[model samples]
Target chain A: MADVGDLVGRARDGEPRAVARLISLVEDAHPRLREVAAALTPYTGNAQVVGLTGPPGVGKSTSTSMLLTALRAEGRRVGVLAIDPSSPFSGGALLGDRIRMGEHATDPGVFIRSMATRGHLGGLAWATPQAVRVLDAAGFDVVLIETVGVGQSEVDVVRLADTTVVLLAPGMGDGIQAAKAGVLEIADVFVVNKADRDGADVTVRELEQLVSMTRREVRGRSWRQPVVRTVAAEGKGADAVVRALAGHRAWLEEHGELRRRRVARASGEVEAVAVQRLRAELGELRGGERLAQLAEAVVGRELDPYAAADALVAELRRG
Target chain B: MADVGDLVGRARDGEPRAVARLISLVEDAHPRLREVAAALTPYTGNAQVVGLTGPPGVGKSTSTSMLLTALRAEGRRVGVLAIDPSSPFSGGALLGDRIRMGEHATDPGVFIRSMATRGHLGGLAWATPQAVRVLDAAGFDVVLIETVGVGQSEVDVVRLADTTVVLLAPGMGDGIQAAKAGVLEIADVFVVNKADRDGADVTVRELEQLVSMTRREVRGRSWRQPVVRTVAAEGKGADAVVRALAGHRAWLEEHGELRRRRVARASGEVEAVAVQRLRAELGELRGGERLAQLAEAVVGRELDPYAAADALVAELRRG
Candidate 1:
């Protein structure tokens, strides 16, 4: 209902409603999304994007709240994007999760949005990057993307960040389970939350061993990931996690990997959008009768999938 | 490598090596894939596709092995595609899991393959369907697709099946976790494995309640998903599962849902291949310099992603 330029201007001026409106446009893939993107592009690429992710019951929300307070204490504006890739019916549950951050709900310096991947064609692949851009253009000092689970989609989401912090807790599972979840390589920083609980040291040690066993280099530069201990529920060790984040950010900047990561993220975004557009074109060509016929032929064993795909692509090109 | 026609011919004769080679081609997306598809298409559309999926430690492997035994007992050839969406480093662990099904390793009537979503661009989206087609064309009467974990990718994999079975065991959370994993809607049948355990009844009742609460109709026909109790480790209740599968298949055929489901599957397969081809084209266009330039502009805040996508699509059209 509002003009794109006016919405962008108000978002940059730190109006929560305007920022929410811009993100809704991105989420819904509104027809004016191009206009919104163009209007927001000039003020983008300033926010430091950080990703925090782990398994369920690992206190991700509490840790996010802790980080928000820590960053705000330093006089910085922070935006939180909580992504739930679960079922659409879990919205009520996610609302409960979001209420855990009630202390920061009224803070003028904080902007938080929860995105669900329900009914999305690509399942957060394309929408997330654009949502991050909206937050970045809004002039937030740091944008934290928090995902609910450690599935493939979550990994892809965290990969969009300048710094990715993987949270773990005692009694969740061992390091082998964590590695099997494929979190070892994506973590720029590791937080062993619930540190005061039993087996906290064991978790830290196991993670340290796993990290050492699978040492990785970014852009041919070795930046050994550090493991920090925290009890996020009580807000203990938040500063240490913050320090670890700052260290990773500095390392990334020193290695000139930040721009490279951003470019890579942008490249993925462009590819997703292009492929999505191609799919849409294929779905729309001849009102999908061509595709339906090709599928029927394939099902009838008169044609192979590759041949069917070729025919569909040809139709798309002609269209 | 053997010629595609020769390999396909051997595979149709039930040569295990030939079957393995053909699947490798599909897995690696080899250049001769189109030839393989053409050679195998005529023999497809004959195999029954059943997808078995659940949370980890839900006895999926055991149930799959049990079903293999049951199907083989009925003189029907069975093919198993156990998809592991876990870490690539967990290959050794997966090998151990695969060895659990070693009883039929030497059976000429059974073909088994374990597919890991490692280093794949689409993460088993395109590969699994082709792999299933290979087994289908190779004279396998039934193809069972078993996926580990209940993530979004697993759900997508199971959607390719004609009958989807969601397995659960006692103490593996409750109905809510299963619902949140988005498996309830995809399941045509639910298997409560390890039914001898203490909480098995409760799990079954919870699942039944959840299924009733979320009752869905297929093409205007209401088919209530049935919950079967099974102690798969001891090979009990597998015959019941087979019966349930048969009942569902018969229902599908009677309602013409079988052809509709197959056509839908083929359509998805076509769409995935079309999208993948477009992505490959985009990656190869102008040696990717054009894409890199677009990404740099987007990252530098000079162009929005939609505009970047538009420019890339323009280049693709010209090409």
Candidate 2:
């Protein structure tokens, strides 16, 4: 029941409870969510947002833990958002992941949260950017958005990041499948985890070849993606991965791609919010007799879906 | 391009090329999509929609083929919409499945199409029901919507069906995992495929228990979902599966749930079309300087995302 301003003040003062409360509001789509977002707006845009993603069994959780340790060793407060888009039903599929990160559970400098879509209206698109804003405003130096599975929604979530790290293991499929999944294009830094395994060199070579093949240029400057090798379970290659992240960040800044990326992300976030608002409006209109009648007519084959939609849109406009 | 009315007339006369062309228009979100939908509306509401979904390796393709043969034997035309929400990148992932169903390629009574989301604007939501309408209007007696994977999007696609069949194979996973994935609640009929394989009995029993434990009643009538056994590769138990589908359809009509379900489906179709229209309008607004300016303000932290969304929605209304 505390005021929004008080919560934001506490969150900025390193209070994890206050930070968690703000994100809970975002997740639940609380009525006062707009007020909270407005209150936290001025303090955001300071944290570096990085995205981590890969297919299942790629040790995404382990690699994320290693990165957390490496970042914390440098005295930087970190925020972690582990997103599970696949487990919309249980919302408990990530419990094992949270348990694996138990070492940092008690550290005040590290804050971790797992999010699921769970049949929400706008799904991840509506909640994720707001959660990132909350973490950024909470004074976290780095915000890592780690997602499970390599679906389109996962790619959309990772695209909100300034830098994206894609993890792959030796035996997990070939680099071709990853390319087919569109991960190769979104990855700013590629990590071949479990580098001590048998096929580690092959994975590294494949990723290097793939990255070299797909040359991308932004604003007349091209940044060749670097593929790093890591044994995340042993924490052997965390520093190198962190260095690659830093290099990509610096390159983005120098080329002015960072602001452009942020603007694009903001544009998507704004559009998702606007669409969600219109969806809500549509639901309200449905609560009345308008949508039901149109649906009845469509079911009766008296009105087509597009014509019904046109009528509904006209109603929405009239409102 | 030929006239949409001419295409609709050809489709009604069982010309597969016309049917294919109309569905292509739906998939591409063509400018004349509304004309096609409007033209096809009156002839719809006759085909029975059956949705089949489960995890991979469940022999969904084989079962669909078996059902196709069974329905063709009864002198009925059947249409199939195979949805691949996972392989959004490689639309070619389902090429093998399509080739597997090659026996029906020459049959005039059978029509098959595989659809992938592939970065579309409305995704499966906006395109699927319209595709179903196209098939329904093309004089197909039964429309089968078979979806790959058990993700939330797959569930949403299957919800458009009058009777939803959830396929499970022996040794795929336990019933608990299926329940956790939320497929247990959506099944009107459960098929335990590969029934000759080991553990098929246990899987069937587990599903029966799960179905019985979560009994659902609509309009004071309760229909217990039947779990059927099938060795789809050998074409065994296809009759039982077909019988189960008929029984469920009969029950749906007797309880008036058929009309209710169709109305709900129409409501969703209309809502998706409306939302797609609004999204297009938003895209137009984004092309102007208004959305870009608001996004810049959001990135600069001068205006929050919610406020930016409000401005965008206001602009959308003004349009």
Each prediction's whole-model lDDT (CA):
0.85, 0.87
Computed on C-alphas against the true complex, the DockQ of each candidate is 0.45, 0.58
Docking class of 1: acceptable
Best by DockQ: 2
Model 1, stretches more than 4 Å misplaced?
A87-95, A170-173, A176-182, A197-221, B87-96, B170-173, B176-184, B198-220
Give lDDT tens digits, candidate 2, residues A1-319.
Answer: 6899999999999999999999999999898988998999899889999999877778999999999999999999999998876632334557789899999999999999988776878888889999999999999999999987535676678879999998888977757777766777788999999889998888888888888888688977888999899999999899999899999999989999999999988888898889999988987884677888999999998999999999999999999
Question: What is the per-residue lDDT of model 2 for residues B1-319, given as tens digits with 9 covering 90 to 100?
Answer: 7999999999999999999999889889999998998899879999999999877678999999999999999999999999876542333556789999999999999999988776888888889999999999999999999987535776778989999998888987756678766777788998999999999988998888888888788977788999999999999999999999999999999999999999999999999999999988887884777777888999998899999999999988888
At residue A58, candidate 2 shows an lDDT of 84
The residue pairs found clashing in candidate 2 are none
What C-alpha lDDT, on a 0 to 100 scale, does residue B242 get in candidate 1? 95
lDDT of each residue in A132-181, candidate 1, tens digit only: 98989999999999986535666678789999998888887646777765
TM-score of each: 0.92, 0.96
- For model 1 the local lDDT of residue A87 reads 43
